[model samples]
Target chain A: MRAAGRRAPALLVLVSVLLIAADHWITLTPLRAFGSGVYGSLENVTSSVTRWASDARRLETVERENARLRAEVLTGRRPTAAVAGAAAAYQVVSAHAIGFGGDQTVTLDVGTGSGVARDMTVLNGDGLVGRVVQAGPSTATVLLATAPSSSVGARLETSREVGLVTGVPDRGLLRLSLLNADAAVRVGDRVVTLGSENMRPFVPDVPVGSVVAVEGTSGALTRTALVRPFAHFSTLDLVTVVVGPGRPGDGAPQ
Target chain B: MRDPARKPAGNPAGRALLAVALVLLAPVAQVSVVNGLGLPGGGPDLVLIGVVTLGMVLRPMAATVVGFAAGLAADIAPPADHSIGRHALVLCLIGYLCALVPADSSAGQRTAAALGGTLGGALLDAALAGVLGDESWTSVLGGLPGSLAWTVAGGTLVAVALVSLLPRRRRFGGPASRAAARGHYTGGHHA
Candidate 1:
C-alpha cells in the first residue's frame, strides 16, 4: 500500500517485459525443455492414473496384438489396410497423446529419444492429426492442423489440382485456397497433402479431409473451400509420428 | 499483518510452500486433465483463477511474485507455443490489483473484484497475443464471449470459498472498516 508495496509489483512487471523481449530474439528452447521435463513427467503420472492400464506402453502393445488377432480371426486379411498401407511407406514411431493445449496443440509421449523431431508428420487411423513443432528429450509438441497458424500444401484426391490448406480455427475447419482461378472445386471432393520434398512435415496422399463447402462464386480470384478433417480432434488417443522414409528390406509387400 | 490463525505451524514457510504447489500443479492439471475434458464454453483458465484466489490472501508483493511464477508455468507448459512472459505480465498486474483490495473488504466486494480480475486477465492475454501478432488471436477473439462467461463463473466459486475460509489480515484497518466487514460478511472469516 506504500512505496515498498507498489515497487515490488512494478519490478516484477519489468522483469516480465524483459523476458518477453528476450523470447522474441531467441528460441528459448532450454526453458521450454525444462518445462517439458518437469511438467510433462507430471502429466504422464496423472494421465496414467486417470486412464486404463492399457494406456501403458507394455499393455498397449499387448492390446494392439490382441486387436490384430481378433481382426484376423473375424475378417481374414488386415482390417486396417488403409492405415497399414499408408504407414508402411514410412518408418514411424507410435506415441500416445498425453496432453492438450489451449493453442490447438497436443503433447505426444514420443520425442527426440524416439527420433521424433520438429516438422515431422503425425497421423492416426482416420487421417492427418498434426505436425511436430517442438521436441524435448522424452516428449514432443504437435501443432494441430486446426490451429490458426497451420498451413499445409494439399491437392485434390481425384483431379490432382494443387492448393494450400490453412486452419480456420473459428469454424473448426480448414480453408483450402486453390491456385487456379477457375479450379473445379465441389462439395465432397477429397483433399490430401502435397507432401514436402523428402516429406519433412507431410507425406503425399495422406487424406486431409473432404470439401464441405466452396467459398466465393464461380470465377473471380483464387477459389477456396472449407474442409472437414477426418480425425476427431476431441478424442485423440493414439497416433504415429513419421520419422523417415522406409529403409531397405522394408519395401512394399509383393 | 499475517493472521496468526491462518499461519499454522511454520508461518511464512507454509504459505510459500502452498504458493509453489499452486504454481506447479495448476498448469500441469490444466494441460493434462482440464483441457482434455471437452468442457462446454471452453472452461476456465485454472491457473488464472488460482492467481486471483491466492491474491486475496497474500500481501501485494508476495501475490505479485506468485502470480508471475504461475503465469510463467502456464506459458511454458508443453504444447503452448505463445511467447514466454506474456501471461506473466497479465497475471502479475492482476495479482497486484486484487491484493490492493484490502482483506477487510465485504464478501460482495471480494467476489466482484475476483471475477473482475479473471475477466480482465483473460482480456489482457488476448489483447497481448493480438498485439504480439500471434496468429491464433483472431480465433481466440471469436471464442472470447463464451470463455469470458465460463471463466467468471469458475472464478466465483474459488473466490467465495477462499474468502470465506481464510482469516482476513485486518491489523491495519480501522474499527469502522471492521464493523463494515462484520456487517457485510456473516461467514465469520476473522479466524
Candidate 2:
C-alpha cells in the first residue's frame, strides 16, 4: 500500500500532463462528445431544479426574476420592432443558457440536434450574445462577446464606419477600433456588427453596443471607443441562434 | 485524546461514493448554479473546494485520482473551451497536496492547507491558461483578485465545516461514522 501510494500521485500527474498535450495537439472529439452527452443532461436537470426551487416561493426577489422572465417571454412571443425586423430575415431557434464558465462562455441547452451549428450567431432581445464555438450532441458552447479572446467585426449603426471590436474582459465592455483613422465617433453612437460574407458568424445590423467612451486621438492609426453591450451577460437566460436565412414567410414573423 | 478501539482507516464504500459524487455533482452545480448567480468576484470555485475537502479525507493517492477525475469533468463540461486537461493537472496536484496534510494536524493546519491548495490551484489554472495561449496574462491578472478572494472564502468555509464534522462523527460512532467509513479513512486528528 505504501509503495502504491508513493507512485500514484506521480503517475497521475504525468497522465494529466499527457492529457493536456494530447488535447492541444489533437481535437478529442469523442471524449468531448461523451462529456457533453453526460454532463449536458445533468446541467439541464440542475437548472430545472434551481428554477423550480426559486419558483416554489415567489417572493420579493423572486418577483424581479419573474419580471425579468416576463420581459423575456414578451420578447420571445413578440419580437420588438428592431428584433422583429431582424427576426424576419433569419431562421432562428430558441435556447436556454444552461451553464456559464469563467472563460467567458456559456452552454446553451440546444445544439446540432436543434440546428445550432458552430459559427452560428446567438442573440437575445437586447443584442448579440455571441457565436457558437462548439456544438455537442445536445448542447452548444458559446464564446461570449465579453471573453478576453473574443473579437468581432463591427461598424457604426449610423455612419457605417467599419471597425473591429475586441473584448475588454476586465470591465465587461468591448473596444471598437474603426478602420479609417479619420472616421468620426461619438460617445452615444450605436455600434452594430459589420458581419461576414456568408453571415455565418454575424449578421449585418445586429446591434452590438453603444459607444460609451471614445479613446485615443484623431491622428491615431485608427479611432477606438469603449462600447457597452446591449445584452446583459450577467443575467442571460433565453437566447436564440440563427440557423439560416428566413424564407420571407416563416411562421415566427407573423 | 486517542481512541484505541477506532479503526484508523474509514469505510471504503462511503469514501468511494463521496468521491464519485464530488466528481459528478460539483461541476454541474458550479456551472449551473454558482456561475449563474452572477455573484461579485466571479463567485467561488466549488469544484476546487470539493477537491480540497475530499483530499483531506482520502489517502494521498486516492485524493489525486479523485481530483483528476473531478477536474476533467469541470474541463469538458459543455462550456469549457480552455485546454482540455488544464483543470485536471491543477486539481490532481491540489488533491495530492491536501491529502498529505498529516492526520495528526490541528484544525488550523488543515484549514491553512485547504486555503493554500485552493489558491495554488486557481493560480496554477490561470498560469496554465497564459502558458498555453488560452488567455492573456493581463486578463487573468485583472480577474484574479475577485476570484481569489471568493475562492479562499469558499475553501475556508468548506474546510471548517468538514473539519468540525469529521471529529464529531468519529467520536459519536466508531467504524460506522458516515464520514470515516471510507475504505482507508484515517482517524488520528482531533478537531
Candidate 3:
C-alpha cells in the first residue's frame, strides 16, 4: 500500500503533461467520434436554455423601452424614417449559437443546414460578428470580426465616409485605419460595411458599430479610428448568419 | 479513530468494486448533473475529481490505472474535440499525486491533496491553451469558480460516501469490528 501510494504522484504528472500535448497536436476525428453523441445532446440542451434566457432578458429590456415609448406615442409622435431604418439594420435572425472549436475560432451550427453559406456574414444585431470562414455539413467556423486576420472596409452610415477595419487579436478589439484625410469621422458615428468591387458578401447598409475613438492628424497620410464592436462575443448566445443576396455570376459557382 | 478489530488493508474484491463504481459515476454525473445545471463555460470535469479522490484512497498503481481508464472515458465522452487520450493522461497524473500523499494523514489532509490534484489538471489546461494562443479569459473565469467548487464538493462527497457504504454492504459494518473473523483460519490449520 505504501509502495503504491509513493508511485501515484509521479504517474499523474506524466499523464497530465501528455494530455496537454495531445490536445494541441492531435486531430478531431477520434475524439469527436467518442464524444459526439454526448456533445450533441449537451449542445441541444444548452442551446435551448440559452435561447430561452436571452428571450427572457430581451423581453425585459423591451418592456422598459416600450413603456417609455408609450408616453411618446400618447403625445402623437410616430417613428421617423431614419429611426426605423436604423432599427431595421440592428435586426438579427436569432439562431442558436452552438459548438465551438479551432484555435481562436468556433463553429456555429448555422450553415447551409441552417441557411448559412460560404462568405455569408454573421452578426449579433448590434455590430459585426464575422464571416463564415469554412462551412461544413451543418456547421461553419466564424473568422470573427475581432480576429487579427480579418479586414472589413466600412463606411460611416451618416456621412458615407470609408475606412478599413482591422482586428486587434490580443485585445479582441477592432481598429479602423486608412481613411480619407477630410473624412468627417467622430466618436459616435455609425460604421457600416461598404460594398466592395470584388464581391459584397455583406449587405450595403447593415449597421456594424459606432466609432469609439479617432486618431491621426487631418492632413496625415492615413487616419485611423477605433470602433467598439456591437456584439458581446464572449457571452453571445444567438446570432444571425446572413445568407445575403447572390452576387453576379455566382449561380452555377463559376 | 483507529479501529482495533479487523485488518486495515481492504480485500481485492471490495477495492475492485469501488473502482468500477467511481468509473461509472464520473461520466454519468459529468454529462447529466454537471452540464444540466448550466453553471458556466461548459460541462464540469467530474472525471478529474473522481480520479483525485480515488487516488487518495487506493494504492498508487491502482490509482494510476483507474485514472487512466477514467481519463480515456472522459476523452471519449461528448463535447470533446481533441484526441482520445488527452484527458486520460491528465487524470492519471491527478490520481497519482493524490495517491502519493502519506497514508497517516487525515480527511482534512486528503482534501488538500485533492485540491492539488484538481489544480494540477486545470493548470495543464490553461498552460496548453496559453501556448497555443487560444486562451479565452472570459469563459475560463466565467466557469472556473463553479467548476472548482463543484469538483471539490463532488470529490469529497463521493469519497466519503463510498468509504461509508462499502463495509456496510458486505454484511458487517462500522470499520470492520471483528478481528477474529478477519483472522479466521481453515483447512488443516489445527494449531
Candidate 4:
C-alpha cells in the first residue's frame, strides 16, 4: 500500500498530461457535447433563480434602448444605407445568456437547433456581444469581444478609418490597433464593425463602442485606442444571434 | 502488525466519494453563483479552493487524484477555453505540493498553504498556457493580481473552516494522548 501510494500521484499526473495532449490534437466532440449539455442544464437552474430580477432589469434596458433609438431617429442619425442593408439581410434569433465560461466567454441558451452556427455574430440591445465559437444542440459558447483571443475589424464612424479591435482583459476595454498614426481619430468617436466576408462573423455597421483614449504620441506609424464597448458583458441577460440571410421578398427601402 | 503511520487516516471510499462531489459542485457553483456575484473579471476559482482544501487533509496520492479530477471537471465546464487538461496539470502539481505540509499544522500555517497553492496554481497554469501560445503575455500579466487577491481571500476562509471542522483522530493509548493525561494529572506541572 505504501508503495502504491507513492506511485499513484505520478500515475495521475502522467494520465493528465496525456489527456491534455490528446485534447489539443483532436476534437473531443462527444465529450465536449456532453459538457455543453450538462452546462446548459445547470445554467437553466441558476437562471430561473434570477429570472424575475433579470426580467425587471431587461425591461429597463429595453425602455432605454427604445428612447435612444427614438432620439437617433429624431436627430436624423438613423441607420445608414449599409446598416439598413445588413439588417434586412440578416435574421435575428433571440437568446438568453445562461452562463459564462471562464473570464472571456459566455454560453447562450440558443444553439445549433436554433440555426446558430459557428462564427455567427451575437449582440444585444446595447451593442456587439461576441461570436459563436462552438455550437451544441441546445447551447452555444460565445467568445466575448473582450476575450484575449478575440479581435474584430472596426471602422471609425466619422473618419471611416479602420483598425483591429482587441480585448483588453484586465481593463475590460477593447483596444483598437493598426490605425495610421496621423489618423484623425478622436476621443468619443463612434466605432462600428467593418463586417466580414459573407457576414459570417460580423455584420457591417453594428455598433461596437466609442473611443475612450488614443495611445502613443502623434506621428507614429500606427496608433492604438481604447474603446468602451456598448455591450455590458458582465451583466448580459438577453442577446440576439444573427442566424442568417433574411427573407428574400421582404426588401424594404434602404 | 500494521503500522499506524502507514494506515490510511480515513475511509478511502468515503474520501473518494467526497472528492467526486466537490469536483462536480465546484464548477457549477463557480459558473452560477460565483460568476453571478458580478465580479469584474470572474469569480475566484472555487474548484481550486476544493482541491487545496483536500490536499491539506488527504494523503499525497489521494490528493493528486482529486486534483486531477477537479481540473478535468473545470476543463469540461462551460466557458472553458484553450485545450483541456491544462488546469489538470497545474492542479495535480498543487495537490502534491500541498500534501507535503503536515496535516496538524497551525491554522495560520494551513491558511498560508492554501493561499500559496491557489496563487501558485493560477500563475503556473497561466505560465504553461502562455508557453503553449494559448495565452498572451499581457492577458496573463493583467489577470494575475486580481486572481491572486480573490484566491487568497477565498482560500483563507476555506482553510479556516476546514481546519476547524475536520475531526482529529486520537490513537488510543498514543504517546501524545498519554502526555496530555499526564499533564492534567500533574496539575499542569508541564507548563
Error of 3 at B179 (Å): 13
Per-model chain A TM? 0.87, 0.87, 0.64, 0.84
| Candidate 2 chain B weakest lDDT stretch, 10 residues | B1-10
After superposition, the stretches of candidate 4 with alpha carbons farther than 4 Å from their true spots are A52-88, A178-181, A216-218, A248-254, B1-17, B100-102, B105-109, B167-191
1 versus 2: better lDDT goes to: 2
Report the number of the highest-DockQ candidate. Answer: 1
Candidate 2 — which residues are off by over 4 angstroms?
A52-80, A248-254, B1-10, B169-191
Tell me the deviation in Å of residue A69 in model 4. 8.4
lDDT (C-alpha) at residue B121 in model 1: 92
Candidate number achieving the greatest lDDT relative to the actual structure: 2
For model 4, residues A1-254, the per-residue Cα lDDT tens digits are: 34555577788878878887888889776766777777666776777777866788878988998898889888988654444455556787889888776658887887777778889898876788999998887788899999879999998988888889998876779998756777877899999999899888998788888899988667777888889998898789778888876786644212
What DockQ values do the models have? 0.49, 0.45, 0.19, 0.38
Cα error, candidate 4, residue B185 (Å): 30
Weakest ten-residue segment in model 4 chain A by summed lDDT: A79-88
Per-residue error (Å), model 2, residue A67: 14
Ranking by TM-score: 1, 2, 4, 3
Residue-level lDDT for A251 in candidate 3: 38
Clashing pairs in 2: B10-B181, B10-B182, B10-B185, B11-B181, B11-B182, B11-B183, B12-B182, B12-B183
The CA lDDT of each predicted structure is 0.82, 0.83, 0.59, 0.77
TM-score of chain A of 3: 0.64
Q: Write the per-residue lDDT of candidate 1 for residues A19-85, one digit (tens) a residue.
A: 8888999888999998889888888887777776545876877799888878786876775555666
RMSD (CA, Å), candidate 4 to true, equals 6.4
lDDT of 2 by residue, A1-254 (tens): 44566588788788888988999899888878887899988998888777778765646676886787689787776445566567667989999899998889999998777877889888888998899999999999999998878889999999999999999966889999999988989999998888887888888788889999999799898899999999999999889898888786565422
TM-score of each: 0.87, 0.87, 0.56, 0.83
